[model samples]
Structure formats: C-alpha cells, structure tokens
Target: MSRLGVLRAVCVAVGLLPALAHAFLVNQWETIDTSTKRAQAAQDVQPGRAWIEPLTGMDMVWVEGRCFKLGSPPKMEGRDGDEGPVREVCLSGYWLARTEMTQGQWRRVMRNNPSKNRKGDDYPVEQVAWDDVEMYLGRLNSFYTGRVRFRLPTEAEWEFACRNGGQQVRYATGNSAEQGSWFQRNSGGVSQKVATQRANRLGLFDMSGNVWEWTQDAYDSHAYKQIEPQNPLRLGAHPFRVIRGGAFDSKPAALRCSNRGFEHFSLQAANIGLRLAAEVEKPVKPRPINLRDTLL
Candidate 1:
C-alpha cells in the first residue's frame, strides 16, 4: 500500500473506534472537563473567614500560615525596647479584613455611632474599645444566622496575617514606604480613607496603616519568648489588649509587623479600630461503617 493510503486507513480506524464506544468516550471526556472546571473555579476562591457568610460581607483576604521569626533583631535600625528579643512563632491559616472596619460596616452591625470623629462612611471606624468590638461581634453573630462568628484576631494571628504569611517586612506590604502606607513620610498629617493604600500580597488592604487594630490577646513585651508554637501565648488576665499595625499618625518604624502596642480593653482612642477573626472550617470526613448480613 502507498504511504498516503496507509495513513488514511489508520485515521479511519481511529475515528471508527470512537464510534464503537461513543457513549463511554463522551462520558469520560465530560468527567475530565468537569473536574478541570471545578479546580479552576477553586483557584479563584479566596480562603479563611472570607469564605463564611457574615464576614463575607466585608472584603477579606487569606493568609496562609507558616513558621516565621517574630520580633525585631537587636541590631535592627531604630529598634525599640518593646520589639524585643526576637523569637520564632508558628501560625495557623486565617482571614483578615481587607481594610479596617469602616464606619459603614460598624453602623450596619452595631447600629450606633461610637466614633468621636466621624470622617466619612468609608473612613476607618475609630473610638471603639476592645469591649465594644466584642459586643459588636456578638450582635453580628446573632444577625448572621449563627453560622458564622466574629472576634478579634489573637496577637500572633494578627501579626502573622498582617505580614501576609511572610517574615517581617519594613512595611506590611513590602520594604517601600512609597507603596502607599499612611506613615510619617506620607500620611500628610491625617488619617485617610481605608483601602486608599496599597494592599499586601494577601489582598489585605491598609494593614500597615490607617488605624491600629485591636488584638484579642493581652500585651506583654516578652510574651512571644514563652509561648508554645502550637498556640499563641497570652499574657496574664490583664485589662489591656495588644494593638498592631501603626495608625495614620505613626512613624515608619512603628508600622513594622514586629512592632507592638497596648491599650485597655475598654479604652477608646482616635487611632484605634478592630478587624475580625473567625474559625476556619475543615471538611468533614465520612465514617466507614460495617454492614452485617441481614436476612429478609
């Protein structure tokens, strides 16, 4: 047979084979295409509390967890007494608000204005105490069908999420202040609207500056040194809670992910606001069962 004739015969055989098993072949291709589509759809999905209902109303970003060195090195430039003795810490996955809680979100949930100085609906809601935030979360949880809950991130979780699952960067986004953080060099003397600055790699907006975020754990400068890697360490049953990320009025050094501050749970400040954390849900596995033979 000629080479061209042989090639045509091979093509005819291949096409005829598909016709012989058309239904099975079509079903297999459909399954493969469906799986591929599902996987592609998952890639577009964000992680953590952002996937839950109530918190989903606000734009949130996922922070994949890992072990990272926490705190400042002794030789770091402009190091402060509070940044302290460096240490290693491990974190679990979490979601953080893309921006500080805006007055709009606060009003939606709490239904009252607590901010002493209201700038605009989009501005970070300030003058909220830690206790007030907890109260707000309680109400939000009830309003959202009880499926989702909200509370402040623990100190370690706050820092880990703010760092966007990476080691300390000069600012939360990166080393450059020109990247739009409201710090000493660029804030121009006042707090700007939330989300006005560049977002961190995790898509969390205004992590470096806007307003300081209240953390669930209490403050202690040496707290990290003694905490277990599996669990975040909390200082004594103190009235004060940790606050992280610098405010609009802060200097560059203050915005470092390692920097820490403290305030009483009931104390409200113009530069303070709250971001929420909720538990991550894991897929439930089905249990295997033994079926004994039964007589009918």
Candidate 2:
C-alpha cells in the first residue's frame, strides 16, 4: 500500500525475472524427433569415395565393422539398470564425424548458429534438437549432390565408438573423467572448444562430455532386452530419442560409456548437440567368371 513497499515489490520481481526467463527457455523445447527427414542421395554419387563437404571441413572417420559387447557391465559403478542386459551386437563399417558438429559447421550448412556459447567457431554447437538435425542432414545431403549420406549415430554405434570400438574404458578415453572429459567440475559452466582435451583411442575428440550427442535410436526402456546380433533397433517411433556421452553441466558419473539419457524429439537445450554417422557403401566385387578379378 505504501510507496516504499511498492518499490520493494517491483525490485523483487525484477530480480526473479532472469531465472524465470532461463527456466522458460529450458522448458520451451518439448517435441518429438523424426526419422525420415533426409532426402535420398543423388543417384550419381560414387558410393565408396571419401568426400568432404566444402563448407564445414568435417572429416569423416571410418569405424570398421565388428562384433562387440554392448552396454555396461552389471557390476560397474554408476551403471543404470536400463543399460543392461549387456548384450553382444555386430555392426558394419561406417563413418562418423570425428568431433561433435561445430558451430561453424552448423552455420555453414544451416545459415544460423543456435549455440549458447558463441565463444568460437570450434565450440561444439548446442541448442539443437533431433528434428533440427534432420533438417540439417537433409540440407547437408543436398549440399554434396547426395554423394554423402549423413545421419545421427545409432545408440549402439555411439557407445561402441566411445568404448573405442569395444575396448571398454570407463569414459571414452580413460578411467579418469577429469583427464579426458569436460563436465561440471572442469568445464567452467560452458562448452569449450573441441579437441582441446585428450582424444579417445579411436582418435575421436569430446566423446565423453562437452555436450550430449544425439543418436538415431528412439528411446525405449525395454528395447535392449530384445537385442539382435547386428545393428539392433535403430529405426523406430517413440516420444523421445536417445542422447549419450554427457554435457558440460553433467557430473562425471553421467559421462561413462554406458550411461544413457533421453530427450523429447524436439527439445533443444543449450547442452544438447550431435555427431554424424554415415551409411557405408559395400565394396563392389567382380563376378567369379571374370578372369581378371580372380587373378587380383
């Protein structure tokens, strides 16, 4: 009722506004992901050639095909129940982006940067959703005249690579999260430039933390129970898609190779981003009747 009381009320409201605004932005991203967002590659693309997108400078790294154990060991500390029954999975060789897609790469393809940390072009681009990534891939596919096929790494592929093609290290690189990953205790509350820390044995950087990487699989609590031997349960319909590794704000426990998290298909948060996985082209072989092929 008094002038002083009204002034104090206004001051208090103003003080609360920033926190409320941040929360609103965090909650605003609530939508499902789409799987069929990419256009088919151009018919003339030479399937087996190593090609580069001119704008992004992203070099695709080849991960060889193999049978590997998937999921955390039951007795491993910080392992979640959902990460079991620790089945075996076999996968074909494929290409994956060597680091999280950078802001420069995203901007070159999408014409805008949505990352909260705009400190540099090399910083991992965050604030991206699965749907947004689909659009980016659609455009990226078109950019290379369909010669390049890029999509999110499946949860199995991601975990396999983070484990260094099945070496089974706790984090992607080593036992100590502080040495190889950027998490709450080390990241200073923001994403740092990629490749600044030590890389994994596979020569991939930022696989444990920095930002959570989106995968192609839809989130399902029971899906792991029905595991197939090869490329299991990648395509599907679900409310949320899987996101793995962890983010700068995460604690070390979340950065383990088997730790899993899910986000609504459309929820783009400051700490969520993506790495790219590519479809592999089977090598063409000459027919047995060909004399030259047999000689080779």
Candidate 3:
C-alpha cells in the first residue's frame, strides 16, 4: 500500500516546500477555513524514503525524525485532559508500516489468523492483544537476523508520523476526517480494508481511522511529563497501554492526531489492531525506565 511515487515526489517537492522541511512551532491547529488549505497541507507534506519488506510483502515507509510539541493545546477541538502539559519530542528516523498489519501477513508468519472477523488476508488483523503482538514480532524477528528489528511504534513516534512529521494538524489526512478515513460517520459500523482510503502526506494509510493501533508505551494520563521529551517512551508494567488512531465506530473527534486512548494490556477487541515499526542498522536495545535517566 506504500505510494512509492509520493516518497520520490518528496525529493522533487522539498525545494517547493521549504517551510515544511524546517520545523516551525505552531501553538495550535488553527482554524481551517477551506478545503483548499487542507489540500495544500496534504500537498506540502514532503516525506522521506519508502521500501517494501520482501519477507512478508509489507510496505515500509521511512519517517524522517524531527522535533515538535507532543500534545494538543487546551482549546483544540476534541481536546483530552491528558493531552495537556505538552512537551517537545525529538525522534530518530525509523521505518513504519505503510498500513496496519494485515491478516494475511499475520497468518503467513504465525501459521494462524487471530482476527475475530477473519474477512480476508488484506484486512487489518484485529482481536490482537499487546502480548500477542509481541509474540508475532518475536516470530517475525527469528526469520530476519538483520539489524532492523520489528516492534510496535512508541506513542510519540506514532503521533509524530500521524501528524505528518509533527505538524500541528488534526488528522493524518488533514483537519477533515472525511477525506481519507473510515469513521462512525460513513463506515456503516465496519472497518474497511487497509489502504482502501487515501494515504496521508507521508504515504501512510489508515492512520486516522479504521482501527485503533497499539503502541509501545504504557498509558499514563501524565505521560508527557513522566517521560523524556526526546524519543519519548513511557515504559512500565502498567495495567493499561496506549492505543492510537480511532476505530471504524469512532467519532471524528476521537480520531484527532492528539487523541489518546488506552485499554487494559490484555484486552482484545474487534476494533483494535497493530501496526509495525522498526529501527534499522542497529541491534535492538531496551528503552529506559525513564528516558531522562539514560541521558544522564
């Protein structure tokens, strides 16, 4: 589902979108008056490289790392109480799946499909718990001994990529949820196939709606302050883990880029799925209990 051309176009469009190439701090999402502005935001998202993993035929896109404020302003629509006490987050470049991990990919490795619906191979695999996802990654890693290791994205990284390199946007497809997402308004109470809708500026699909994506961090309403701002990952044996993006039955407000959701670590639901993320050319290392402690 990766749009190779969009990644290639980033190189051609970089000069045209100089403002985007450099990070500018915007305090708020600001009001979007017309679709023209939204259209321009989508066009200006000069993304990085993209490639496909041959083993599972998974399309991977490179998310170029940059720093930006990590939560929503207090007055923003759909603002959650936990989104406040915003902090800046700087990340390192990493590979992210162009779409949610599909049932086909899950079955190809695990030898069984765990999704409740089991619609087909192309559908996003749901009913996966956090530990189940970790097991899948473990099985996936045994096949490839290369330096690149597969895992769930950290919430910061997920939001950074979802916001199109940390831009002050509301959704992956821009402020409008209608353009490239399947939500309560039009989903008819069902999740659609991955990439059935348009991709975001970074050539990623289903980041706003379709299914809730599990992340590496534990859920903490005060996570922004609990973790370090750089490559933030809130690690703990917490009861709940962070989940990103909304589901097919989710309201548009729930799909906001900064929206926060959490579920018991073992909870599995029809609307929850997982996306793959990876760090390349290095052996996987453990994240710190407190990211700030590692720096000291």
Candidate 4:
C-alpha cells in the first residue's frame, strides 16, 4: 500500500475513537441508572446482583449502605412533633421493591384481592392490616424455595428511601408533594395506579403518597433516641406498628418524608398497605470431605 493511503487509514481510525468511547460510556451510564444494585455507576456493580421478585415481577433497587441523619429537624416546615430529635443511622445494603404491592400481585399470592379500589389491578393493594401483610410475606417466602428473605422496611429504611437515600427533601421527589404524589387534593378520593406519580432518585414510586406503607418497626414516640448505627428494627410489645408515606386521603403535610404515622396491628383501612423489602441469600460453600472418615 502507498504511504499516503496507510497514513489516511490511521487518521480515519483515530477520528472514530472519540465516538466509540462516547458510546461506551453512555451504555454503562444507562446500565448504572437501571440496575438494581448498590452501583451508582457501571464501576460499582460487583459479582453479586439484584433480581426481580419472581412472584410479583416487581423491580427492586439496592439501598447502598451509608450513615444518614433521620427525622425532621426542629422548625422545619411540616415537621411532626415526633419527627424531632434527629438521629444518625447507618444501614447495611438491602433490596427494596420499587413500587408498592399491586392488587394483581396480592391476588396471585393471597388468592383474594382486598383492595377497595377494584377499578384496576395496578392500584396499590389496600385495606390490609399488618397481620395480613405478615401472612402474605410468609406465603411469598414459601413460594421462593428459600432463595431470598422478604419483609417490610424498617422506619429508617422507609425514610431513607423516601428521602432518596437520605437527602433532606420535604417529599420523596422534592419539596413539592404534588409533583411526586397523589394526595387528598389531587386524588379525587380514590387510590390511583402505582407509579402514576414521579419516582424518587432511586426510581422508587409511590413513596410519598398513594397508600400508607406499613414498616416492620413498632411505633414509639421515643424510639429515635435509641437508634443504633447499624440496621435498627424497633420491635417490642408495642400495640401499634409504624405506617409511613401518606394515603390518597392524606394532606400534603402528611406526605412529608419524615411524617410518622401508625395503625393498630389488627386494623385495616382502605388507604393502608405495604411495600416489600428483600435480602438475597449468600451462596453457601461446602466443606471438603475426608475420604478416611468416609471409609469408616
């Protein structure tokens, strides 16, 4: 080949490198955005990965481990009396369903849908008591062949996710509840379909409003004082369990990220429901067998 022709080929190849590099970065960027892992970018995805819940086909997001200040600060707008005395909490990474359990998912597991809004299968299942949620989780776990563990998020986990991994936002998405939620003023007095509103930074939906989600924590006015640095699950003989987010009947103030609510464990309401949290089981390694012992 002529020297000029070879030089031209090298130049053309060099010119294409930038475009190729840009495409590669864009691909990884999108993967990071969509992936349900602790990965904030392509570089963060490790050997372990997250998965969709088989029974419900729900998309889950990994909440990365970190320390964050929980509860509303004094004098913050819409602060509840119980939202005070801010606490620092650190949690280990875990998986959380991106949306509330829909009516269709509930029916598939429980053999009956208890949602008051029979208009559509996508609406969050409501009228479920905390006790009912426990039964659903039991059946769901049994269906998985012990591959994963599932339960309600703790109050800290709920608040952390709602704040988009512990940002100090008033609502899940931002300060404006209307932008990220369906509340009394805009709900038309009915539960809307899940994910109809904006999702938080983690791509979780219905985190500000839709239906109040039951947490695993037992309700207590003074629990924040006892928060531990690790994953804190406040369980005791309390009569009421924590309920979070807000409901279709709730006002904007009630939809604030730190707003705390509770319900009797046995009580069910049309606007009360749950979101599921999951933890993948680590693979077990078998010990080496001894041939000498086997001969005996």
Which pairs clash (backbone N, Cα, C closer than 3 Å) in model 4? none
lDDT of 2 at 2: 100
Q: Please, what are the lDDT tens digits per residue for candidate 4 over residues 160-195?
A: 999999998999989898788999999999889999
Q: Can you tell me which runs of candidate 4 are displaced by over 4 Å?
A: 1-50, 282-296
Q: What local lDDT does model 4 show for residue 11?
A: 61
Question: How far out, in Å, is residue 98 in model 1?
Answer: 1.1
Locate the minimum summed-lDDT window of 10 residues in model 2: 32-41
Model 2 ranges with Cα > 4 A deviation: 1-52, 281-296
Question: How much lDDT does candidate 3 score?
Answer: 0.83
Better of 1 and 3 by lDDT: 3
Clashing pairs in 2: 31-266, 32-265, 33-265, 42-146
Which run of 10 residues does model 4 get worst, by summed lDDT? 30-39
Q: What is candidate 3's lDDT per residue for 158-277, written digit by digit as tens?
A: 999999989989999898999889999988887788999989999999999999999999999987767786788999899899999999999999899899999988988989998999
Each model's Cα RMSD? 20.0, 13.1, 19.0, 18.0
Q: In candidate 1, residue 127 scores what lDDT?
A: 92
Ten residues in sequence with the least summed lDDT for candidate 1 = 29-38
- The global Cα lDDT (0 to 1) of model 4 is 0.83
| Tens digits of per-residue lDDT for model 2, 68-139 | 888877899988888988889998777778889999999877767899999989999999989999999887
TM, every model: 0.73, 0.77, 0.78, 0.78
